[model samples]
Target: MGQGQPRRHHQVPQFYLRGFADDSDRVKVVRFGEQPRTFVTSVKNVAVEANFYKVDWLDAVREDLAEKLIGKVEDAAVEPLRLLAQHGELTVQQRGDVATWVVLQYLRGRGKRVDSVGLQKLMLRADLALGGKQRLASRLGLDDSAEVDALWDSIVVRGELADPPTMRYSHLRTMFSSTISKVAAAYVQAHWQVVTFQRRRLFTSDQPVCLWRAPDDDPGVGLLTADAVSIPLNHTTGLVIFPQIPSGITGESAPTTQYHRWFLAHTWMSAEELLILHPDDELPDWLPAYREARLGTLGLPDIQQFIDIGEAWRTHQDRSQPAAEVSF
Candidate 1:
């Protein structure tokens, strides 16, 4: 809030973005949507939002606490990331630092913030529904019956709340503290492979940390359940992570095959693709698959269909069996 304080907070760190940048510190941004277009811009100008990490309730002096903390994490990981990108090797401590940074990058994004808020709202709604109006009002500190009735109508009947809950920077910090260790531990334990491509280049988006699940995996996916996690270290290099030595897979080449499969299931939002960073060279190989995957239509069979078929078969079997009733 002070003069010269940073108002624009980048969700994706500029230091990481610089890897995808050209020699002039510019990046080619491919905006995807109904009207997809490409343009060149400075890395600093993209993947940023005004007051993104600002804690509005905090005092001016400490308003940027989240930004400062994130900066420290980024600083610690910068060299480790650089080392991995360049030489594909890191000390144990350095690997830990990079893993922490990657986890933070995945969690501290606008999309994740939205998800947090939505989950909070869903929990609140469930609580209100389970607890009657009077109980909900009492819990919320509403003394008047009229206020309680109004609140119930607004939230339960209309599906709208006057004051929606939000996930502030402080809450985000709390989330980082609680979950960072677990998530980063998974990253550290996983087998990390640094991939350098001469025939192809990688691009990144505002939500750059790609958590990928296999086509046949369960629909519920997260860092823990992910088949692989990938992030583009630079246009020419990337880091891919997989579970430590899965069955039937051995040696160095397995990661590459897994990476390609992971790529086939990855999806991204068009709005979040505002600042896709790509190399200045020719279009990369498998561009079509990448584009199709981005649109979330890789032509793969839907997992839900199999689940539905199993459910239907179970229903048929239940109907065929003699029913028993219990009287209490």
Candidate 2:
């Protein structure tokens, strides 16, 4: 490290994603003793490590109930309105009113303003969930809150729909994970991506490792140390950060939030999970809160599984490759 000089750019080492077609499972393996020293190959039978994009509530509801709820708004009460509006299954007035109610119900579903719990429950079932108030209020094209409140009161008494029981954050958390992972998985499914692999070999002249060529250097080559991918996970930092996504495309138009979509496709988190996300900032604003709030709750056990998987993989690859039959 020296002043008055630019930070050095270490040349990245190149490697092939080699693999042979497996007979039964059909997987390719980047192996040794092959004809060409450096070449690319596809790993068909590779057991891809499952990135845990898990969620809950998938098993909570029954079969028929689940089918009815699929693509529904998800809120216990307002789901019906969203279902009808989204599916083009409602009348013009019904659709307009229901859509408005969907927005309002979502805002209030967090229970941030639950002063009168009974009224909140009533709103959840009738005015907000069922768009009962929206129906009457929209008839006169009135957006005033007083009129909507008046309508809300009218529907609850008229319908007499029972209120739902109390639920806590656990219910919300499951819904949150399910919703986020769905968006993230969809994003990843749509991104065109590449993952390269690499390996090492002995130098022809037995020269020592050198990173870069200097301005006043000799024309003859020298040994080079490069940031080689495909090494054991332990050899380097096992991370692939999507700092910034590429903009614009040649063919089809990109999504408006393409960056957000790309982020979820590459990163561990999802679009919804990153609702208040700040990808541009050097450090994420909610990193501390997320780890403290979520990770602390997971409760880790003894004997970590991936303690040295990276290192072991690198070592295995090196061992499999016979060290330069002639090191000179």
Candidate 3:
């Protein structure tokens, strides 16, 4: 609310989005729903929500703290991302910087915020089901039976009071401040590869980072459990993090199969629809696959079964449960 403070906060950093822009610095946006449409706009206008990172619970002087912190992360990652995009090379420190940026970006999206609220509601519903109304009321610190009954009805019957913006914002802040470092460390230790597409330009979304796992591998999806995580750095360049190097393939071998699966997963997770970085003169025939993928009817085979990749390296050698499912 202060003079010159940023009121429009971008979920996806503009510098990163510009990597997918055209000669005129505009990007194509495709929206999917009951009515789908396509349009072109500057990267500044997309993937942004007014005061998205504002911490309203904080004092006015520090309301934009999260935005300022996010800006620093984006600034730190600029050079490392450029190096990876241009030369596919980075020093160890640069790799860690980029990994940290990716982890934060993955968690800071609107989709993740929505997931956090949904998960909170789900856990409350589960507790109520298992512990009954009185137990749930006690857990919530409500001693009045009337208040407990009303709260239970709102959650169970009316389906209200499930989404609280302040609580969601607090959870997001906690994730960025507490959970990001551990996840980023795992990404730094994972198999890193730069993928360049000679003929096809890639699509990114409001949710840019894509986490993919083999349908049969594990139900959990996260940086540690996912067989691969990917993000398109530019129209032609992208990064894929795999659990390990495939058994016999050279480092140069692009995981094309994983790319498709990740693309599908990214499409499904997008808050709106796929972002076409560069719109083809004629709409590509494969565009339909985005919708099909979102519908779970894409019919891509279990390609991971043939990839022959090894197990993921864990941060703690003995801990189990696959690093706590950062992705849903």
RMSD of each: 9.0, 32.1, 12.7
lDDT on C-alpha atoms for all candidate structures: 0.67, 0.26, 0.68
Superior by TM-score: candidate 1 or candidate 2: 1
Flag regions of model 1 displaced more than 4 Å. 33-36, 132-154, 162-166, 215-217, 244-271, 279-328
Candidate 2's residue-wise lDDT over 155-241, tens digit each? 443434443333322333333344434432322222112222222111100001112223453543211211110111111111111
Candidate number with greatest lDDT: 3
TM-score of candidate 2 versus the correct structure, residues matched by position: 0.16
Model 3 TM: 0.74
> What TM-scores do the predictions have?
0.72, 0.16, 0.74
lDDT of 2 at 103: 27
Candidate 1 local Cα displacement, residue 229, angstroms: 1.0
lDDT of 3 by residue, 59-154 (tens): 899888888888988998999999888755677687778988998987886666666665665555544554556666888899999998898777
